[model samples]
Target chain A: MFEHLSIQLIMGQLLIGLINGSFYAMLSLGLAIIFGLMNVVNFAHGAQYMLGAFAAWFLLTTFGVSYWGALVIAPIMVAIFGLIMERLILRPIQHLDHLYSLLATYAAVLIIEGLMRQQFGSSGMPYAPPLRGGVNLGFMFLPWYRLWVVLFSLLVCIGTWMLIERTKLGAYLRAATEKPDIVEAFGINVPRMISLTYAFGVGLAGLSGVLAAPIYQVSPSMGSNLMIVIFAVVVIGGMGSIVGAVLTGYLIGVVEGLTKVFYPEAANLVIFVIMIIVLVLRPNGLTSGRGTST
Target chain B: MNSDANAAPLLQVKDLRAWYNESQALHGMNFDVRPGELVTLIGRNGAGKSTTLRSIMGIVRKRTGSICYEDEELIGKRTFQIARKGIAYCPEERAIFSLLNVGENLTLPPVLRQGGVPDSELLKQFPNLRERRKSRGTLLSGGEQQMLAIARILRTGSQFLLLDEPSEGLAPVVVKEIGQLILRLKAQGYTILLVEQNLQFARLVADRHIVIEHGAVVDTLSAEELVSDMGRVKNYLGV
Candidate 1:
């Protein structure tokens, strides 16, 4: 069984793992922030990711925009969509229990995915790689786009972590999560803060979708497929901990890749297995960072 | 300017009713606090002392009636909007962000008034907080957390402060220190509406006492009235 496992194969798979982990971290970070701030699970996050891909594709095909242009425009469009959703849909149900918001987002996912399918059809479409070349490492070949995804994603994850944990704006977001009323009583508009927070989280999801379009086919179901894995990452990382989500995302993605090398059969099931173990052992998640306040 | 006793009250609440979902908390509550006056709302656990403060701050959603601060009605306003109109609230739970450091928590509230107390001045007033500026809020003792909560609003330039049970669950010595802090705030000319179960602490600083019972104003007394009518305080508060 170990005979065919060469260094090149392992390194290649590790690269793939890193790319997947980058996406997991990005998506889960957004989820964690939204959950931390508003206590909403944001089930429509995947749909928003899909919308980002579609927006990029539309910019390229319809407006003759380049990958770079989509990179800038797509996330903003999706974020605006998220802002509308939050203000119109999520805000109304905000006073309800967390479960209702979760269900509402789940409903939003269905509506968004359905609309996309009707417009673009169910077939996957190819998105040309922006860099159009590969870099040959000592042991294996690395695609420029994949490397871009990894580096850019690392930058985003770190930047987002700093923004939330180390800045004055972040202080307001965290404080609002614990006690919105008190934060409001401090003369900070908490409802507006909450809306902007939701927009930011959804914007992150949109960015990930733009990054993912080149690697995976642009399709209606692409985000939904990846969403389950990202959810597993969020749970293992902990529901609302930013650092936990990022670290666990990369760790689990690599674990899944290694499993593919050692035992190909367990690759898909590996993340869920880890999630189950974490849930049983630490029900609050690996890092319980500042659980949401009612 | 601070000696405006003959002018309209700095803060006034009239027939303010509020509720949590369906259960009512403030039932036609009415009270007033003059500029530079330290007023305490004193009653037993369920007498709605806290509710009265929350209602005035617009923290409770189902509030009705009038809360006039500087003559602006606050009945339909959001808590943040009411806060911007020169009021701050320090709740009984302290409401400190467990994830934030002491200094961050101290300076968290955005300054609304031009002459809001600066962080340096607040740190001078709270020397312990200055020492523990980098410490996480959760690591602080109950006394320290209470200090952070109250001190947090000072820098926002809020002319009015609503403090709920600042001395609750603290050691007697800590309570004494808090009592002194209240006197210091009073001397600096900040109007205050304090909610407390501790009659002794109220007596130490408040110029007037408003007794609340079942979500309404049952009586009002000056420090002199309170001293003479200890039996009334004891009866209503059951302390």
Candidate 2:
């Protein structure tokens, strides 16, 4: 059974895993940041991501905007929506228990997805790849757009990690996450920082959506399926660790892909299974005490 | 309200009332601090010494009454806005960011005004912090953490410092070091509002001592008066 597996088959599954890992990294990173700072489990993250893909589609269909232009405009549009959501919805109930915030975001998910479904039906819509064609390697063929997604998302994750870890703004963010009142006492406007942080987190999710638009179908439920997987990734990595989220995302993605090759039935269950195991062993996740989350 | 040309109070609190949800912490609290004056708030554990400072800084949200600093009312202002008005607070608990190193913690607070103390002078002032600049905030000893907590705010360029129990949970020698640091800051023309349970430490540095009992100021004594009347101080503090 082991000898029958060809090089092409192995390489293909690995590439698929890498593609899934890119999305996982991007989505989980956003979730980690939002959760770390605001202590709000942003269940609307998936909906916001779907909106990103839809925004790209709408821009292309209505305004004749290219994919490149959508890449720039879509995330900004979604981020503005995120700001509005924070101000109108999240801020009002921020003082309540953590459970309320989770519920509110979950409601937001329903509303956003429902609205999108009403506008565009449940059927999937196609998006043309920004970079067409594939490269023929010795073992397997690789699509340029898939490669772009992997590389671009990798750069994004690294860049975001650097911004949060090495910069002055990052220092304020980290401190604010730990103690918002103390941060405010230091002459910094902490409430405004919370709003901006929520926006930035959602903006990253929107960016991931735009990147996924060309590969996956542009549909209302696009993010819902992936959201659970990303959440599992976040838990396995650690609740709020940036490096853990990034690394665990790719690692799990490859593992899931490997499961598909070895045991097709376990591919979908692998992430959750890993999540449960991590919870039992290390309740704070793999990279504990690295971020604001307990 | 005195209208003397040179004796205007930098901080003035009148009839301040604060509550932690339903439990009242402060009731009709009143006090005043003039520029360059180190006013010590001395009281027993439940007498609202910390609450008075917190209300002044807008940390206690359910607070009412006037907290005028430099003639500007700080009653309705947010914590950061009050901070921007040249007032810095160091809480009794010494809330240092555990994840941040000493160097990072030192630079955390944004300098409000133009002429705040620079990093070099701050590090020079707290030599212990300079030695442990690269160490995590929680890794420091109790004395070093206290020093870092106080030193971090010096760079904010704030005119008034609200220090709450800086001498708490420190050894005698470390307490003396902190007292010396306070005197040095005063000599450099920094106005301080100190909250201390240690009456001896209060007597050493304060120009005036405000005695609080059951959330209200019962007496205001000069440093000379505090020295003259140890019995009254002991009665109010219950030490």
Best by DockQ: 1
Report the C-alpha displacement of residue A235, candidate 2, in angstroms.
1.4
Chain A structural similarity (TM-score) per candidate?
Answer: 0.97, 0.98
TM-score of each: 0.98, 0.97
Candidate 2: lDDT of A51? 91
Superposition error at A67 for model 1 (Å): 0.9
What candidate 1 gets wrong by more than 4 Å, as runs, is: A289-294, B1-4
Taking the tens digit of each residue's C-alpha lDDT, what string does model 2 give over A140-199? 999999999999999999999989888889999889889898899998999999999999
DockQ of each: 0.66, 0.64
**Model 2 interface CAPRI class:** medium
In candidate 2, how many Å is residue A226 off? Answer: 1.2
Q: Which stretches of candidate 2 lie over 4 Å from their true place?
A: B1-6
Clashing pairs in 2: none
DockQ of 1: 0.66
